[model samples]
Target: MRYGMAIDTKKCVGCSDCVVACQTENNVPHGYSRDWIAETVEGTYPDLAMEIRSERCNHCDNTPCVRTCPTGASHVTEGGIVKVTHEECIGCGACIESCPYDARYFHPDGYVDKCTFCDHRVKNGQDPACVSVCPTHCMYFGDLDDPNSEVSKKVATRKTKVLAPEAGTKPQIFYLI
Candidate 1:
């Protein structure tokens, strides 16, 4: 099963609840974040359009991070969740440099870290911390391979876009506009 997420940009309020929840649930360092809110405003004055989205690792099907890792630390797990095995990571930063989304970060403990879609939680049939704590309920996560899954349905039925699609990573996260 390929896991994925569909985030409704229109529904997101840029409150950053998802970012805080990801940090708290993942025990990420105080200065670092696994996910963040990105806002883009276009047009002029009253005609301006704003889009706010929670961004993180795309868990790409064609992962440059996994390919660039010298130590094989960066890898895709079941459900296409890209993860770094801290013990195997050599703090080389290859994966960080390869990620088009700028999702990977060098940890204080000398390892690379990023979002996992909260794989531990997903394995237990729970949503990712970011998805679960979104006050607007704009985030939907599930197996993308399952046509009936919420994430799959949302992507199929909505005008959605993936980050850096030209990079051809085949990113799993969809931003529903």
Candidate 2:
């Protein structure tokens, strides 16, 4: 099944709670983050509209990072989650350059790092760290292939947008605006 996430922009409050939770759950290093809040302000003065989005790896189906990895360190799993095998990574930086979202980062340990969609928790039948800790309950994660899943239902009913659709990555994450 294809796993994915649906985030409601209207419900997000620009709080960085998801960011902190992700770092804590994944043991992300200092001066780095697996996810972050992106603030976009439109218009001017009293007419200004602000959109706060929690952003992370899109986990694209046609992942450029995976394709650029020489050692097969970056690969897609059976469930369609993109993962990097640190042991096999050569730290060549090819994957970093190819990523459209600039999501992957060079780790101090000599490897590329990015979001794993909390595979550890998902394998244990739990939601991803960010989703579990979000106070607004704006995030939904599940198999997109399953019509019964909340993520799938949201995509079907809501006016959602995927980041950089022209990039041709076919990102799994959908934003409900």
Candidate 3:
């Protein structure tokens, strides 16, 4: 279904609530995160504008991690979610190196780990944990292929950007700025 996300920068407050929620919901290891907050400040003092965004694996249509993995552990599901099968991962670090977003990390359990777009929760008819617990309601997740989906609508109507677009990953996540 080409699942994706749209995050409104105007509504985000850099609270990292999404990060915490994702970690809790995914059972992420201590000191490791499935999501993180990125802040960018422009100008100085009175003329300054700061942007705070929640960042994670983009679940790219041309996912480099998947292409680089030797064991097929990193693969894209039918619904367009890029997921890593921990049991099949050998922690060769090739996937981590291939990702331009620096999203995947070697886990303590000797496997690679990164955001899965919460495909488990999504399959159960629930929003991704990061999107659900956002205090400002800044995050929206749904099918990018469905024009009526909130995420698709926001992307169509708002000024949005994807990180490292030049890398040609064709990331599914859109940041509305």
Best by TM-score: 1
Rank order (by lDDT, best first): 1, 2, 3
lDDT of 1 at 40: 98
C-alpha lDDT (0 to 100) for residue 11 of candidate 2: 99
Root-mean-square deviation of every model: 0.7, 0.9, 0.9
My TM-score estimates for the predictions, one after another, are 0.98, 0.97, 0.97
Q: What total of clashing residue pairs does each candidate reach?
A: 0, 0, 0
State in Å the error of residue 175, model 3. Answer: 0.5
Model-by-model lDDT, in order? Answer: 0.94, 0.93, 0.92
* TM-score, candidate number 3: 0.97
Off by over 4 Å in 3: none
Q: Per-residue lDDT tens digits of candidate 1, residues 49-136?
A: 9899999999999999999999898889998999999999999888888888899999999999999999999989999999999899
**In candidate 2, what are the lDDT values of residues 32-141, reduced to their tens digit?**
99899999999989999988899999999999988888999999987899999999998999998998889989988899999999999999989999999999999999
Best by lDDT: 1
* Model 2 worst lDDT run, 10 consecutive residues: 61-70
- lDDT of candidate model 2 versus the reference: 0.93
